[model samples]
Target: AAEHLAATRAGRRAPHRVAVAGSTYSVFPVRAGARTPQAVGVSREVRETVLSDWLLVVEADAGDWAEERLDLLYGVTQLIAVERDRRDAARTVRRRLAQEVLELVQTGAAPAEIAARLRVAAPVLLPGLGAAPHWQVVVARVEWEDGTAETGPVAQSLLEEILVDPHATGPEHSDRIAVAHTGDEAVALVPLPAVSTEHDGSETGVLADALLESVREPLSAGLDGDGRVTLGVSAAVHSAEGLRGA
Candidate 1:
């Protein structure tokens, strides 16, 4: 299977079936690893592309393996490809929202305009979170050893990865974070539940600390030894006017 993966990376596109330990497995090139747990699956060339080398292998009964099941697996893989494309397209729109909102705030756009944009962006960025949610601005920077590599997209990708919570039920539920890249920095716009009238936004400071704490280890490892990631989290802001200061 490893040899087949090597061949695939070397530009070979043919699928292969291999017998291992009395069982046969079907292998196919994938754009990314299967999110769901399967009897067999593997991913190689993780950083090669947005969709890297994903090897999907399915276990087969000794003599029960049939063309019908093989065809079913291929059909499922095609459905996964479509879902991946949809997810990528949706992410692009979310990133664009973040970028446009950031630009509006930085350029001192009218608060009404910013608020309007937020209204439009709420459904996409916050999903089921709510219509009027408090927002936090998290700024992250990646410095590489060579200092020549582009950091915006790298930071953007890392931000998205870090923001996902394992306990979340679905992609939309876990995707409360949206990131936009400006210059060499990636800024994440995180939505939180609105504060009660009795409390101020200071509670969000705790949330900010927790965000950093939760991601510190994984992010450090992802940056490796040659790069460093620095994060700055702002206090929660409930209004467009406060977003700039946040």
Candidate 2:
């Protein structure tokens, strides 16, 4: 596998046939580890401008490996690449929105301008939630003992994962969280329905406490001794100025 990966990195586009244990296998390079290959498959180079240092490889059963199978693997790999690109684009847009909002809040931009930006951002972050819903801010920081891990992206991803309500119904419910990274801290903007009977304006602490309840044990296990995760949840804010204060 290492040799085939090297060959692909060195500009070898053709598939390689190799023996593993007692059987013959075909190998292909994949763009990233995220692209899960079948039991038997081919690998393709992941490229943007210059080729990435990694390849996507798929492996298949030796007896079933044929020209048609090869074509099928290639097609599947292409589809995965397309999906990867789409995800990257969506992530870029979300990150930009988060960053912009963070900057505006930090710089004390006009309430009208900040409100306009939030209006634009509402659909992407909160999706099906209607206009001007109450919002909560959750700040998370992950600290590693050796400072080796990249905490910003990791915290952003983890914050999104943690903010999702596993029992919630509807597609848009899971998409109601948006997180931005500033230095080592991840800031999450969460939207709540304007009219939840469970809590009122001054009771955002209830919501905040609930956010960490289910995720705390699992996340603590993952952090273990190597790192620590701390979170500060703010009260619900109704307007752009309120968001800045939160």
Candidate 3:
């Protein structure tokens, strides 16, 4: 997989094929009749504040953008940029709120104070929820076998991506999550809906297996051979009092 993006001269170039993760190297393969296909396109990088190595590849049928409907491509790129801006803003809020909540938790603040903070953070984190959801803690540590001072920030970014709710409706597009980093660790306060009466609580909330299911390979490749990430999920807790023990 090619992960690094590079500046390209103005126009389209055709490359056979390659693989990538959360890829932006856009390839628009066009075929005429039953012909196999002509592969070529332009690569434009979209600047996402959290993870910016995304490339947009556009392969065309005519070997160039002029009659290949370049206007439509520009529109698509603009749409993507706008959506990235929206998501990035939401993530910034989540990180800031997580930092505050983690500070209170670590300092052993009163449960009442913690609960109050959670209350204020709830609406922002879980917009459109009719009521506040139960909460859980997800703790992750990212470290290099060789070691580096950048571990904490890296962990924070990784956790944010992992915790996003792919099915989430509306603009936030994330689980009711607040993630903060301290030292080599990132802690996420994940908001969950209440368990139903007949169902076992065990069936609800995040599971370590499920959280890592899709991301395991990508995160591994990102570690550069000498780094690793470890994650743990806490049982759901109802209020601030349970946050510490969780």
Candidate 4:
């Protein structure tokens, strides 16, 4: 299997690839030892350096290898770190934007101002969201065994996971979903394409179902018997008045 994978990826081999359920990772040998072999995985715990020439994980049987593997491991580690950092930075920007919106809503800021903020933050926080012809809100709550999941970043984490599907739109619509966390509950602001009045609005139900179906199982895992999760889907709002209602 390992040889096949290496052959498939342009003759580049990762001698000791670790498998973790749905994910597979590559580790390259760094140094040779009497018994143990020094190697490094594609992952690194240090966020500051983000990449390292040193080995990440030392295994019991690393064969003698040169710096060639070390260079490959370094490049892979850097790529992983860059992706992770991009995701983290995007999430932080979204959270800050959400907080700003919440405050503006409290301070009686004009809808135009709020909309401007959203437009600025949307693409940066949730990529692939173009001009929104229509939008909807999704509200959800999760009750955990110790209630920890409901209180902290877990709610935001769960919410992001639920709304991660960018293509969760109707056949007639050309838009995607953008989600953000508020407080104990997370809210999704989904965009829609132009719809004819002749089309039944029930198409939104399909989206809601998709959201529910994707989250039900993973949510069940994150939650215990003490953990309870409930969600409400607001009617699709084509206008500003409808958004206010949601």
Candidate 5:
């Protein structure tokens, strides 16, 4: 399918451009045999074209402005490429970790085995060996009013958007957090420094609130009835053994 699209673009004489956003791509398909400006109903040189099949003719004063906008569009295209690559890498890591963790929980793997898997999947996101780490788990509930098959893709897309900044509710900081969706729920594992205090109730509440608030509206479009998502945040576990209990 992609090869066919590439061939179509390659056959065109007019400069073709493509822009990507997340998993979707917007492509400008140049009309076949459109070699010059006269073929596309333009008096002056055509500087830019849009997905709508309209040519942006270059004018005297607007040429520079049009060129600048095209440059910005190119930058946006680059950003989209980077974002797609980052998401792909992140998904791969998360899938591997989830599978390893499941094996550890179900088959009772040794701590060393689990740690080895962690190192392979997520070295930077998870703190290295020795001291115990804190963990949080989240589950998503998918609800559709009419119950269409498109709901799944919609939910998946929204989950990706929420993972943009897994931590942080406000616009201040975008905490680098890892995210993975399991079945109908997106299981988000938040790692923090080991906290073993009784007065950490406020901190727990804040974290829970942030997670719920950030995911609420983004997942609302596909939900209906009394359906609402509630995240199950496990208490700070010292080891992989505790993940089994949660």
Candidate 6:
């Protein structure tokens, strides 16, 4: 699989045969894995210039994937690419909204104006949300060992992945967090369910410690020699004015 991916052009989506030691997978893409040569499968790559790209490999229990089946697989890839584009477009809007909101908070905009903006943004940022949620802000920083890498988008992506609700699936997680990045820092505005009927904006202590402990080892392994991720979580706040303290 590594060899096949390495051999393929990252910028192209054309179907190509995946050749193995003694045989070829053809455009049907059934030969790269350990499965028997007769196992039915299809492979396709979805290329995205604006967002992350992915390869799709579909396997069947038995039989061969006839050449005629390639058309169906190709259609499936098209649908997937369409969905990817939709999600990417939505992410761009979410980021822009996040930037505007963050700027309002930092600049001390009128509370009524910010509240109105938040109200307008609620449906887009948290789809199908029942009631308002208390908001928490987490800021992340990525520091490279040699200090040459562009860390803003990297940290932004990392925080998006890290903050996703673990119980949800796929793009559903994308709508739940608004992240904006500048320079080497990414600020994530996360919404948590209101814990009680009444709430005071008190400091939530040690969020960073608990989060750091859970993520450090696995993150360290993935980083290997790249860099480190640092995170700090603020006290949950309920109103637009409260966002300043958050």
Tell me the TM-score of each prediction against the true structure.
0.61, 0.60, 0.66, 0.52, 0.49, 0.58
Residues 1-246 of candidate 2: C-alpha lDDT, one tens digit per residue: 444534443454445556667766666543333233342233421121111122345444534567676666666656766765665456667677778889899898999998898888888866665556777888888777778666776677667656665566656443566678987788887776666654543224226567677666545544545567788888788999899889
Stretches of candidate 3 above 4 Å error? 1-16, 19-82, 128-131, 167-171, 195-203
Residue 33 C-alpha lDDT in model 2: 37
What tens-digit string does per-residue lDDT give for candidate 4 at 1-246? 222222223323334555555655445433222012233222331111111122234332233456675455555555655654565565665566666755565567788887777666556533554455555666766555554333434454455545554453543131134445655666656554344343655335336677777656544433423456677777766654455567
Q: Residue 197 lDDT in model 4?
A: 43
Better of 2 and 4 by lDDT: 2
lDDT, candidate 1, 74-157, per-residue tens: 667667767767766778878888989999998999999999988878877656644487888888787777787677876787
The model with the greatest lDDT is 1
Best candidate per TM-score, number?
Answer: 3
Q: Report the alpha-carbon TM-score of model 5 versus the true structure.
A: 0.49
> How far off is residue 72 in model 3, in Å?
10
All models: lDDT? 0.65, 0.63, 0.62, 0.48, 0.43, 0.60
Regions more than 4 Å wrong, model 5: 1-78, 106-122, 127-130, 145-176, 195-206, 221-230
Poorest lDDT segment (10 consecutive residues) of candidate 6:
44-53
Clash total of candidate 6: 0
lDDT for model 6, on a 0 to 1 scale?
0.60
lDDT of 6 by residue, 1-246 (tens): 332333233322234355465555533222223132223232431110111123455443112556456556655555665775676677887788778888888788998888877776777766666787667889988877778767788777667766654565544866878888888888887766555332532224226676676666655544544456778888877898898777
Which of the predicted structures, 1 or 3, would earn the higher lDDT when compared with the native?
1
Give the Å shift of residue 124 in candidate 2.
2.6
Let me know the TM-score candidate 2 reaches against the reference structure. 0.60
Residues 116-184 of candidate 5: C-alpha lDDT, one tens digit per residue: 655454444543423345555544445433443323323333444454543445332212244454445
